[model samples]
Target: MGRIEGKVAIVTGAASGIGAGVASRFLAEGASVLAVDRAPAPAPGTDGARFDSLQVDLAQPDAAARIANRCIERFGAIDILANNAGICDYRLLEDTDDATWDRAIAINLTAMFKLCRATAAVMKARGWGRIINTASIMAERPYPSLTAYTASKHAVAGLTKSVAIELGAHGITANYILPGAVLTGITAPLIAADPTLRETYDTMGVVNRMAMPEDIANAFLFLASDEASFITGHGLAVDGGALLKM
Candidate 1:
């Protein structure tokens, strides 16, 4: 049997990138997934497994609850919740407008809060649950032109730890993953636009190469599995030591 056999998971930002990669992995491991994204339809992955998809903007107040409710309505229970939706803009701190900050925080942090809050209610009742939030190396470290992104991700890590502490008694564990540069469709254009970014990307992580989406997805799987039951309130970095660099 697969590690997640007979389980049900919710993957946000599933249309592509890490979200899609995780959803695909979950399906392969025999989990039923409700793939959520702002995209209008089910994303391409998993070799034709017919997982459900919900398109809702995570920045909206109601979107998180709605997605969680829908997952419950369809699957009757949620075993895993992966908060992976995020947006990054190329702008310095002074150049980042209020609207940008608001939008980034809303989607990257607030939405995850709402989903975790709602999902935890059910998980607590059942006495078992796994919550994984996607953070970044920037959460602890820094980089240019990612002020809003870094701040939002930093908040995600804090929220993950807080949730873990509060929900541990109820068997709901919350954690965050810090991924380095991962090769995804989104990054393709950026690299294409400036080939030099590739060199920078290689140095950003300890592995000295851009990571594949599957690399991070596998880490998510490990954290969500029973093997990690004792782990909580931690920011697990999958960044190949990128955050450790001075």
Candidate 2:
């Protein structure tokens, strides 16, 4: 039997990248999943797991409630929530407009707050749940032209900690994953266009290679599994030791 057999999970940004990887891993572990993304769901594959796809902009005010309702409707209860949908606006503070900053915070930090708030209620009622958030290596380190992204991610770390403290008594664990230079939908195009970019990112990691989506997915699996029941309010870095250099 799989580690998470019979669990119900909701994975945001599941169309591609790390979100997609997490959804796939969850399905493989015998969990039913609601795969959500702003893009239309992809054609169903032969993963042989219970998978439902939802396309919704999580930044919308009603999106969190809708997602919670859909999970309950489809799976009867919510066991896990993976808040992974995010966008990055590469601009320095001086270059960033108010709209850009707002949008980044809405999607990256605010959406997470909404989702966690909605799902925590469900999880609390059931007395068991797991909330896994996707933060970036930027959550702790700064990069040029990423003022908004960094700020939002740093907020995510704090938010995860707060959720952990609030929900620990209710048997719901809240933790955030910090991933470094993983090859995702966003970075794939850049790497394809300029091969040198791959080397640049690889050098950032002590492993001397860019991280694959599955690399991060492995961390998510552990955090979401019962094995990690005692772990909460932690920032697990799957950054290939890149932060050591930072």
Candidate 3:
């Protein structure tokens, strides 16, 4: 039997990138998943009745409640919540407008807060749950032109730790993953536009290669599994040792 057999999971940003990868891994582990994203239905990596899709703009005020309701309606329980939907804005502080900053925070940080709040209630009631958040290397380090993204990710780390502390007594675990230079759909275009960018990221990691979506997925699987029951309020860096650099 799979590690998470019979569990019910909710994966946000399931249409593409790391979200899609995580959803696929969950289904393979025998979990029923409700895949949420802004894209239309038919979320990638989903199959049959075990995997359902919900189109949602997570930044919306009602999106969190709607997602929670859909999971309960479809699976009757919430076992795992993966907050992985994020948007990147490439702009320095001086270049970033108020709207840009707000939008980044809304999607990257605020939406996650809403989802956690909605799901934590259910998890607390059940006395068991796992909350996995997707943060970036920027969460701890800085990069030029990523002021808004960095700030939001930094907040995510703190938020996840807070959730862990608050929910640990209820048998709930909250943790975040910090991925570095992952080659995803979003970054593919940028790398294509500037081929040298790939080399820059590749060299940053001690492994001398950028991470694949599956690399991040593997970390998610480990944390979501029962094996990680004691691991909470931690930031697992699947960054190929990039953080070691000065």
Which one wins by lDDT: 1 or 2? 2
The residue pairs that clash in candidate 1, if any, are 206-240
Task: Name the best candidate (by lDDT).
Answer: 3
Model 3: pairs clashing at backbone N, Cα or C within 3 Å: none
Cα-based RMSD of the predictions, in order?
A: 1.6, 1.2, 1.2
Q: Estimate each model's TM-score.
A: 0.95, 0.97, 0.97
Error of 3 at 236 (Å): 0.5
Candidates, ranked, lDDT: 3, 2, 1
Which wins on TM-score, candidate 1 or candidate 2? Answer: 2
With a 3 Å backbone cut-off (N, CA, C), the pairs that clash in candidate 2 are none
How well does candidate 1 score on lDDT at residue 20?
88
lDDT of each: 0.88, 0.91, 0.92
> Which regions of candidate 2 deviate over 4 angstroms?
43-49
lDDT per residue (tens digit) for residues 1-246 in model 3: 888888899999888889888889999988999989998544444457798889999989999999999999999999999999999979888999999999999999999999999999899999999999999989989999999999999999999999999999999999999999888878899999999999998988899999988899989999999999999999999999999983
Deviation from truth (RMSD, Å), model 1: 1.6
Model 3: CA > 4 A from native:
41-47
